[model samples]
Target: MCTYLKNMANYKHSHLKNKSFEEIQMLFNNTLKWIESFVPMDTELVKGSEKVAKGCSKRATYKLEQEDAKRQRIEEENESVE
Candidate 1:
């Protein structure tokens, strides 16, 4: 399904513009149908999923800050010796 979408994305705008009105309408309708089918459509599930992603982001940010602090400390020590 993703591959189909990726291939569809490769279609030039000019090609799409040249399509019949019925074909374009079908494409637009199918897109909305696919969205309704593929998505979870659940608010709670989405919020919970987002929260886990946010937690991972925070942990990654903390790890980056720790590495930055360690690098700065080493750089300061090197400078003090000069």
Candidate 2:
């Protein structure tokens, strides 16, 4: 379980590199929680559960990015600190 979560966190960090560090971290954590709540507990393998996983990741990402519209502008303008 630890390894799985670690890998997911790493993937989230890399996948959402465009996002701020804090936002990615929060989203990554929330993703793990979402999996726990939405995924079936009977199995560890994520086979055939791609939709749930993707939905969770998208939701987490969307939640963070939506709240920080100015952050996107700052990043696009190559400014550091928002």
Q: What is the lDDT of candidate 2?
A: 0.68
TM-score, structure 2 vs. true:
0.29
Best by TM-score: 1
Candidate 2 lDDT over 4-67, as tens digits, reads 4357645643456476768666776787788777856456566647768899999999988886
Question: After superposition, which runs of candidate 2 have C-alpha atoms over 4 Å from their true positions?
Answer: 1-15, 39-82
Return the clash pairs for model 2, or none. none
Worst 10 residues of 2 by lDDT: 1-10
Angstrom error of the Cα, residue 72, model 2: value is: 62
The TM-score values for the models, in the order shown, are 0.56, 0.29
Residue 56 lDDT in candidate 2: 94
